[model samples]
Target: MPLFFLSYSHVPVHRAGRSPDFDRLVFRFFEDLCGHLAAAGGPEGNAAGFVERPGTPAEETLRALADCRVFVPLYAKRYFTDPKCGRHWTAATTGPADTRPAVVPVLWTPYPPAALPRAAQYDLPAMPGDGDEAEEEYAATGLHQMLQLGEELGDGRAGRITAWLARRVLYAAATVPAPPGDRHVPGPLTALDNAFTAPLPAPPTLRITVLAPTEEQLPIGRDESRYGPAAEDWRPYGPALGPLADQVRALARNLGFTPDLVAFDKPRAELRGTAVPDAPWVLVVDPWALENPRVADQVREFDAVRRPWTAVLSVLPEDDPQTKERSERLTRLLHTCFPRFLREGRAGEQNAVRGLPDADVFALWFSELAESARMRYLRYIHSQLSAGGDGTGDRTEGRP
Candidate 1:
């Protein structure tokens, strides 16, 4: 078993529009911390600490958390709210409070002291010198932010602080040695409450509608390779992406949106005349669907209409051979069909509704789509409220 289990929340998606470096820095911090721990532990520290990654066996995590000598938690806003992190913490600190395993809290991000939960706070030893300026600064900046501002992993406060943390973990292993614990936590880890609080309000909704044909409905010569039972299962991106609807749902969840998947068979009346939606909507469109007169009319009607809260995304996978051969033809068809989408004057950024080449591009574009819909909705509602009317803004007459 490893000497320490590095417990932290997993960030699932690369947030849209932010520099990718934020997540890179986070991973680099973890690697550096592990390296520091190993160096401090000497020849015996080959596997000085363990951090879980995707595809790591659950049993391995169960054993490491149960058996490790020290519990090193990486604290951040995400860390507190993640139920998985809570389970790990609960499993590691399984016994009586006084005799619980040694814990070394690694601050990755700062949280207001009062906003902290009992799980992290209760474990902290009540040491004096509470008003110290250096401590306050350290508390405020967090180890991760310090790292972001050119703090090297091996020198200065960042280095020294990490080095001190490593030594403490090593010392805990020596003085309070613990053997590999049984794999079983007292109960199911899933039942454990999250240690830190996630915001209480219901998350905003992102409605996703997949418009495509089922295998049986494909036009004469079209291959049925990627079509599943329904429109939601239309995987224009091929086998690798599975279904676009599911992918959008996962991405939506990562972005803190409650994804509501609407069927393509939804009434046209409801689609056109709705006064306002409780959530923003994204349409996952496969070019094949445009062949069906009904689907195409809906697509064109949706496109020509002035619904800022709706973002239409045309998916024609780049890697798929069938999709590649027809990509240009399909895109041109879209341009001709939906003149408003192809029209040029679309604010500062690229058009929010347009072609997405593949799943990767789809993901990137979907992030923007979600944000665009959200912002447009907010902007419209705000306009209505300021004009001394109910906040239920409708888009019966305008150009998006």
Candidate 2:
């Protein structure tokens, strides 16, 4: 049996003879992954990896999926809908979470987590890349784009990412290998239909604005490591992960909102909450942002004229002791700048954003805040219609 099964939907573009460019890239990637596996002392030659040929029977693919030590699923729009692919995914992931081989999912084409089938949505593990830019590229786009960058597979960043994936697969195989379910089970196991159905409803948009300082705008004496080329690079939570805005974006996506990261410093007509009818704005505030005179002004301006559909989430890191005094001073000053949000949370709590030191707690609060913001937008539209105005809730000329 092959060490891994490369489970993917057979499309004409990815077919061996139909599209030369796609076939070349895919085959090269597969061969390179196999070579990496072999170099790591894994199976070699014909027993290294298995990919079903075009027109292969579903039973053949299912048998390979059942025997592999690891399952590498290339996720795409068509992969979920293909009957054979669905069958493989369902059978491989049916037993207890620990009973199946670890799945290393690749986002061949961009699709929301919500778009995945129920089993896949809960079972797929995250594939973090080697570096920040690389991880962002893989997350924003997919590995298919990386293949186009270099003529040959296993070249440059694409190669590095592939190697990283190969090592992760090998690591999991040795440490957490689980016996796959028997493929010869009777009854519905052999005749089960596709596990997925029609696509789910599109998630609503959340315009995630990051109100933080760029490296150039950072106050003197500040740690430059935390600040990067742009505001989106600000990681208030520390140096462990990506920017706080992106962490929030991932959390937003998990909660069923399509998150859009926007630069708060950029001037746009969409800053007016009513301008974006479908997407509510959520400002992710960095505590040190108040130190800069210009950012402070922007914060006050937003608080003064911001609409109900706009919400603020302030992230204060408890681990950064140096920032504690300065953060408290800013919080006290922030209350005067915006009296409503600062007082509405818990009795002793100055703001809802406080006391959230991690993503789990942040997500719990963000869900309610995002929904509340959406409802406010709907209420505004309803009142406008009830008052015989356009449902857009805005009539003033050039208000933005």
Candidate 3:
């Protein structure tokens, strides 16, 4: 049986996209915590872990809860509202008095302590950056204090938290006499009924669909002699829309929006079925891909959707007379499909020319595209809202 029973809500909370640095930090802490426990010299040390299988039978979850040394609930607003989380909480607290699992609450998100259920209102250790910085600092200090207790407990915030929890589990196992092996099943819990039954809040968002060329449309060429030999010989040599898609997704997240990426190779019928008519789209097109009849036909069908969208036509930095001629011809072909498509301009041109292989340049290009799409989306929302004769309008009808 695991020593620690960790519970957290799986539902994602709506927040304006910021750097995912904090998310990464929390994940690292969990990883380090597990590592610390495994390294701790004891038979039970290796057994120290948490189960997070969602949709498991209630009896199975309760059995796990019953067997644990400590129950660590990562509390947030959503945790209180989720029925499954509530069930877990109930199972931990409602058993025989002697057998009840020791609760360790971690403030994963800021929520009023006073408003929490009476059973969960005890003095508890909280995770960092939820509300109180002082509490986190104290928790960190306590962890470092444990280092003297054992060499396995290393240095760092993650180490400190892990050690602290491990100490708690060990202490509980030693001092708190185990209840009878026979268990009394808990009755249904109603403390969180209001939260569970309440309507969920609508998330604020602007949807953006990204259309990218598939590998077949722009195959990797083995010969690098034609495009001037590089480190690797691959046609359209360089990171494709993958990096650009990541950048777009990050930017959209930051802007309080969600982005959906659609491959160009998908059939037109499939595209239309899933396409959101009101949402703005971004198409990352390769000039060479336009030359293919199949690809051109796909582009034409995509344009027929009649949605507000932006197209980014990629170009190579190296310019010879032959390359320039080919680029010009490609530009003309794209114009037939996307009359106002954005293209890289020369130094003398009004628009700034963006080139691949330069991180800063690519970032700027992505920012511009994202900002433009955001503005267009906002306008679309405003128009819809105005037409509805109310600032708050239901825009989900036509959305995919």
Candidate 4:
């Protein structure tokens, strides 16, 4: 078995006082190391370890050191100056006559090895190259050098310590493990010592669906009724409609709706044939062939997969001289085609550059929508729980 002997800055409780917080951090580092080492060699590769000389007798401590094939020295700012550290370093690193265990030094803090007293610094590996001052130079240089020298010198310090540990500590570093299930566990190491203990990213709340033109060279319409001169010039609305759907989804999110965004782009018949997931709210922007009466069967197909409570934002071009006429025609077409919108929970909404007076108006409206949505969702959840599923009360109708 690959045995690791861990040594760190030690503060005896009677000598100093209570255990400093740094001790916890050092333990966490070793814990993580164990995990990494196990992953590299498999369960059989993992071996028992100790941080300090743990036995009552000096002989017992010596025996533990004898069994240790790898000695991991952890360093920090105080490590160099502490007297106990000096003794521990001598015991761990000083070879007995000719035989010695490989010594791997890991610097937890950024202080330079040069800062260590001459007696303590001697016999260590050469110092790494200098780096930026803003960065903790010693830690970065030392760590990179350590990783480069992996498994060869029998000197414990080399080769991908962080990466190796990552795989070992969290089984299969290929995927991030899900967080703890119940009550939160206090980290073995605090933030001052370890980065791995921080909280993971929250899962995404909104899904975005991006819609773009299906074909590049579809001819401009010949009939004036199809669209005016601008409509004929409307090469493809998809490119212009990129961030607009995000803005609409932001509005929906603020209104207490969960959004799942999907992207559809041009020249792909797959987009035209695809189905949108059933959501409480959906925003379809610049649906490329959606307005063509010939594609009514294709357009209304969204209703087949969606729920009754869906709010659909159907985006079409207002790119003609008669903007109002185009909008009115589009609205009527949506009403006729998507019969789902005529129901109680479903509604048709539209957005255009014209609706926003300026950036200020847009910002204010967006903020208001988000606030209202959160408040509405909160009230709905509260009501659902309180009314025994009847939803009987007015639900925060008049409250200040």
Candidate 5:
């Protein structure tokens, strides 16, 4: 069962236009919230503990609420007005008097306690809204004082909020008793404010050079193959590099890194110019595409460099005998290039590679890769900080 269910209205009532600013803020909040919770051994500390998103089936939402130990309602004026949001609140609190889930109301938007539903009126911690007054209040607290140090070191509001929300969720998760009749109550939760108090680790500035064939290079005109007859259809049925690159970009944003994507055919000087010379580079290789002499030369040039580089070999699905043969050929080609490459597939399966057909499984594999890359980058940053040197460590050859 999940430790808590996060409930919020995705659309705002008063806002006329869909503001990108608001969207970014919310996205960063959840990312940091879950990241911190996972670090603190909360339900979100693992892959299973996921925040419920919009468009979830009503039955599914109810089932999740029934199993969750806490219901966290992100209260805004718009939240109470939405029927779906109201139903979510009702479903969590509506059962038998003793069995209702515990409510942890988060005042995401500043509204009086009277504005909330009668069932949600219990005293709870409220996060400050984005206002000067709230900022002033936060600035007075020890948490804010510690965060000031991070800000001085270049951490922004988003970093501060991540640390703040993580600490808040940790405290809430630790102190709140489990829902009634829960057989397995979690052990005592300890306060780890010190973790937040420390200077926030800056995300390493890295560039991910995606070495793969473009749509024009791939055989999209052939109807017999899975690449499809149309160029646009290639995204879903063709090689996994494009989609995988997109997934990596999305995950990298959540990890606080803005990675630039460089294609295989892009000039080496342009690639060298854009890439951060000191940061780690993730080379996403499309094995079949590497059959091209120019592409092969690019890979060898990148490998020749002595810097830290991660190679991800993209392969086709091995669902049939013919497909299996093709996938094996690609895997062999990958081995000849890197000798060691991470296969994207089910964990612990030897020589398992990602297949475009199983989008869900491949997505999970990419998410894990992005997370591992983030950790590696974080370690690199920490080492630089510990050495009392500026964040830029040693420079590596960026040409490839």
Candidate 6:
């Protein structure tokens, strides 16, 4: 059984939503790592067992750290500089610098090396999202070096480092011997035969309706191979249609729901346009036609025959007031000028992150839409019903 020590800075106090997201991401990563380890033989037929303890100085926390075979640090902007973070860093690196119980550091953001005051051995890359070309180039080189280090550390190094988790960390919680002087050492949940089991929740069915102008405005093309050109096009599909179908398909497999997709097109020449059907959930992409304005004429034609639907506009962040004014104007048009709608814009600078050069900003924007749609749909399905008897339940789902 390998003992891993995980540490990070205290959760930010500003955002209430961020804490849950932060904790969920961390725990999910651990779960994924364990699954990978179970595929290997490291954890004695059982997956890696772990005891997730938050950062604390309690006796229990100390005992676990003393026995930890690996030290993992969650490297963020404030983590290396914070006093609490500094103490953990010192303990992990000192007293046994030569020993390889696997010390790993995972960066939350691309921080500059100059910012690191804790230990000088590690070299951080230039911060991404700074929108500096020279900094980005420097960051890319550092990222490559970090990946190489991770490859070198192998599985034995389960520190907070990105390289530490290059493979996966497995634990045999069942194999953990009871600590000396203790009546019983609590084993992994697997020891009780309940570790890997989760009661399947009955997945509620949710409808995802796309209220786009027409097929011409947002084309749906498939590839010969499941993963050819069509697959590539699908990356940008979220801007038009949210990931409700994909999410419904994935979640319903575990729950229950038949996902229905409706597209507004000039289906019949006799019928002027399509009328919006009563759907529990309706998503309006490009609500204001900000990204592509050429399709605005078609959108107007569709809106001539409108139904009560939630609208969301995607905006481009601009540093200048003029561009910002233009973005706000379009967003306001979709909100007040249209029906129930919300507008969302992203920082243009996010596209210029140094470390993630291979990752395109436009691609990421689409990805965010897809992911947000999936999560929003899940919440919508679980909410109470609306008085209108529209399948919307209590969950009024609309995300920009």
Give the candidate number with the greatest TM-score: 2
Model 3: per-residue Cα lDDT over 1-400, one tens digit each: 6666777665442342564332343344455556666566523333665655435565655556667656767666677777777677766655445666655555555554323554443323433322233334433343323333334554344355555555545444443345345655453333323323444333223343333334443434422332222211222323442344566567656644466665545334544663334444555554555676776777766655534433343433342334354656665656665532322221211132222323455455555555444444444544455357552221111110
TM-score of candidate 1 against the unseen true structure: 0.47
Q: What is the C-alpha lDDT of each candidate?
A: 0.64, 0.65, 0.48, 0.40, 0.48, 0.36
What is the C-alpha lDDT profile of model 5 across 1-400, one tens digit per residue? Answer: 6666777766652473755344444444566677766775655553323455545565555556666655666666667666656666656555453455445554465443323344433333334434443343442342323344544766455455555555555454444345554432221112111111233345444466555555557633322343333322233324544455566677656655566675544434533443433544455554556677777676656544423223242546444344465666665665555432332221311232333434455555544454444334444444444355342221110110
Best-to-worst order by TM-score is 2, 1, 5, 3, 6, 4
Q: List the residue pairs that clash in candidate 3.
A: 17-253, 17-254, 221-235
Error of 2 at 361 (Å): 26
Please say which candidate is ahead in TM-score: 4 or 5: 5
Between candidates 2 and 6, which one is better according to TM-score? Answer: 2
- Candidate 5: clashing residue pairs, number: 1
**TM, every model:** 0.47, 0.51, 0.36, 0.30, 0.37, 0.31
What count of clashes does model 4 give?
25
Error of 6 at 128 (Å): 19
RMSD vs true structure, all candidates:
18.2, 17.5, 19.1, 22.8, 20.3, 19.6
TM-score of model number 4: 0.30
Summarize candidate 1's per-residue lDDT along 117-168 as a digit string, tens digits: 6555423311112334334445557777666554544435566556656666
> By how many angstroms RMSD does model 6 differ from the true structure?
19.6
Regions of candidate 2 where Cα sits further than 4 Å from its true position: 13-22, 55-57, 96-98, 152-155, 178-190, 198-283, 286-400
Worst 10 residues of 3 by lDDT: 391-400
Q: lDDT per residue, candidate 2, 1-400, as tens digits?
A: 6777787776675455665444455667788889887887777886778887656676666676677767788878878888867777666655544455556676676665544665554333244523355665665577777877755554476776677777766765664444545534222445765667545556767888887788888777777777799888987767887687778888787778788887775433555544435567777777677787777777777776767667777776676665675776757556655566565532322345453566565666676677556545644544455356432122111110
lDDT string for model 4 (235-265, tens) is 2222443345455566555544455555432
